[model samples]
Target chain A: MSARNHEQWTSPPKLAEGEWVDSRIYSDQTIFEEENEKIFKHAWIPVCHESELKDAYDFRTMTIANEPVIVVRGKDMQVRAFLNVCPHRGNMIERRPSGSFKEGTPSGTPKRMTCMFHAWQFDMKGKCVYISRQEEGYQDRLCTADVGLRELKCEVYFGGFVWVCLDDDIGMTVEDWAAGALDCLAPSLNEEPLEVFHYHKAIIPCNFKLWHDTNCEFYHDFLHYHNRITGFNDAYFARKNSGFKNGHINVGSFEVQYDNYEGFHSREELSFPHLPPNHWYMIDMFPGVNFNLRGSALRCDLMTPLGPDKVMIEFRGLGLASDTPAERQTRIDHHNSIWGPFGRNLHEDLLAVTAQGSCMHPSAEKRNILQGRHENETIHDENGMRHYYHEWGRWLNRSPSNPDEEFDEALIAAASAKPAEVQANA
Target chain B: MAEKHASTIEQIKDVIYKSCLYQDDLEWNSWLDMCSDDYHYAIRAFSPEIRADMEYMGGGLEYMKSLTQMLPKHNTDNSPLKRHCTVYKVEVADDGKSASATSSFVVYQTMLDGINSHVDAGESRLFLVGRYNDKFEISNEGVKFSDREVRLDTRRLDKGSHWPI
Candidate 1:
């Protein structure tokens, strides 16, 4: 809205020959809604790590694609997800984000998911148990089988994260979805079983894609002063970018000497099993999953759209579950140093996307995501962004190069077949 | 032991006020000067996401010292943060060498850029509300913060500044 020459800043930037995305992708409500349906709904998103559900009946509530979902561990020791809504009047069964059903009900009626509205009770398997005076109300008409909570496709992987898919019949497994994207870190994640040490939520004013864009764009490493001092080195520049079959991206497996940065002590104390003390790895999965291992700590965060312009990032820091009290403390300290909410880098990343979002509006003109670099052997390339959009464009049924082009389903299916091979043409 | 810990409540209040003032003014060095040798500063908040009360962020004395030292090298928000702290209770230890103090504090961030550069520039938006659960080591030299845990009631720290609250 600020008066600026259209000749200069208004034009969309080009990333590569075929990798330019208009800013309308962030500002367009129609496109955003379509994304929620086609992309977000069908994709497998890791909502919570299994450690979050420590005990039987322990549950964690999360909202993905504006849908409230509850992932709970049952007495059978299986983690299952149910649509948090009740089948009767659509009231949310459990209001608290997380708790144990084993705590029983207010009337002390064993383990049941009870709706606070009319106290409609259901068991951990989402089976409708006591429908509050069911005998008097249409007895035969309303049995537990007819009123159970809707179940979702849920899977636990790497003994690490709980992956869920809103699409029940979606033709893909988490292994097929991630393929080799998370393979590098899987060994390390489960080397000794890691538990979350730090967790924080940030609801920022930006489109859901803006956060992922920030993660996929390595050219913006200059924006982080601490990264400049420590993370960006000869190894950093030599780090290669790889993409997987389901649109997951891996930016690096590089080394970063934390002691090289001013005031940061040498990270010689503790580390993940497979990684060196001062190493860095970043993985940006499709939809809304990002896992990054930097130095001696592991940070996994996911964001989903709250609205067209609002998104929430739930950040978690993981450390060896078998770590001693002193080791855990060190992990906590190191995690907070850079990856914490008060850290030097994350807020900076959020602010940059926030600034980009401030310029976009549904009524305003489209913006550009120019990711033209193809260094091939460095994290500085835009290949990560290119691969991300390649999957996004496929899912959204649109072309990244041309947003206004009519969506083609066949094109989407074709690209989905070999997404890893989908890349920007030099 | 009581005599050794006998720093007056009024004296403790001054240390709390001075610490808040130093933080608000972005005087990192001066703030560190007031911290005891083993000073540990921490910020904690209840996380619904984690479903537990947890430390969102914090560090020990040397770690905090390094944090403050390294902060200036990073890019922080130019906006100024003003902390309003009220000392509620000061519990002196039986030995009197140390005391625990609690205060309800509110921090506001005021934008200092652009045309809004007058009395209007002073207007601020409430950024955080928390209680300062602090420990002070009262010595012959003075009272210094040994451990300050800012247990924040709010968890939506979307874009917080570089410095500790």
Candidate 2:
């Protein structure tokens, strides 16, 4: 906490209305802690697609905003979530990243979610159905129902992807959150009903937003080694436009030529296919997930925050589900060539983020002053970072507007002001 | 529904071989025409690190047509691929309507000579050690690929693959 001086934390300059970001947001530990509690916990984070959890009792364990959670399809055919922690001894209930569980022991069958620590058995709904010490000296103190594994709120998106928000209510529904972007992205999701054929995971060293923000903006298009291959050099295709829906954003869907491959369309005229072609549409959801639509294919970016400074990025590639093997290979070959973990484009972003982290010394206290391109758009997306901070400010009671309003003071003032408005309306 | 193949299983292998040879020779039009009208193509990378997950690439004929138009126009430092492929382990489906084929392949790149006429970048590479599992449909004209999954036995891909292996 003492690494950054009081002035660095306190009276720092607000980012210009629509200009450069302050760059210190990635380095601050305090902001990171608040984000974990306020943003990641409250926002609905996409964990797995329902397609992955096809069978009964199939379970997959993942950590959202650092809290371990397990998703399983119960015998009754409901997808449920439970804190991955075992209630009895605090060990993980599901050891494997993904698999299935037995509904009941038929003498030879294994129990669902059996805790390795104390062998406490939990049902698909996370209830403590069986206990080893039920009849022992502890026979009187067993409150099984109350001690079930803690459940988190889980919901399914239109496309069958499962999202878990730690807090039951925080922002708009995922549908409302993705409406505009979906209007443009739905064709890809519908045209082929694409499925994730490649699940590439990279444990990069930097804030998830750094990796994502880089993706949100296309100013770095020329830096990609594969750009030489994609012919993105034309300045006109490089134009970018951004929009907002609820608290999310759709950025950089500027037109680019897509139909000029050796055997595909020869000119850019064939680029548009009921949906805008050559444009790159990036939807940055409230907190961590960014769904990018490059005219060629759809790229889903899930950023799991490790700390304020580190994040794990999983890149999911999608293509037409009904295509022939050769056609699908062509899509995959083109898709993986640019965005996979080893792909040329994202590798540059990873390197850039890693280098940015090393440059951020201990003295930095900035919250990523994101005031760039603020005025160009009506919603002030340069304030997109601010919009996130604004959401955070409302949640944790902090403010970039009034720096003097301490977390405690802001909460008290807002609490006191609420009753006055209620009285006046009454 | 299993559709029975009208042609013998042996004939289908030759079609599969011809498709690869055509792609290696940059015969995009001929290769495009070889697939069934409703063909499905995918190149998947399955990693042991993340079990229960298979990542794939998919596109239909129209999409492939569009992709073919775009691939050559894209400015790439590595252009005009030169490599050889070997197809092995041919398996005929019980119905003979479809067959699965496996192959091993290596791709080498030869670069132009430098100052002393020494090659700038020329090397024979072990591109992939995997089997190509293809589901094929044979017609009187030729063998068409219904579905193909390139299962790479090795987990890590070298840098990136410009051409499909």
**Chain A TM-scores, candidates in order:** 0.92, 0.77
Query: Can you give the lDDT of residue B7 in candidate 2?
Result: 40
Stretches of candidate 2 above 4 Å error? A1-18, A102-108, A169-172, A176-183, A187-194, A225-240, A252-255, A259-280, A320-324, A361-371, A378-426, B1-45, B48-165
Backbone clashes in candidate 2 total 41
Candidate 1 residue pairs in clash (backbone atoms < 3 Å): A15-A371, A15-A372, A23-A367, B1-B95, B4-B96, B5-B96, B5-B97
Docking category of candidate 1? medium
Best by TM-score: 1
Sliding window of 10 residues with minimal summed lDDT for model 2 chain A? A263-272
Give model 1's DockQ, 2 decimals.
Answer: 0.53
What fraction of the true interface does each of the listed models get right, in terms of native contacts kept?
A: 0.60, 0.11
Candidate 1 residues B86-126, lDDT tens each? 99988898766888999999998886531134434666788
TM-score per model over all chains: 0.92, 0.64
CAPRI-style grade of the A/B interface in model 2: incorrect
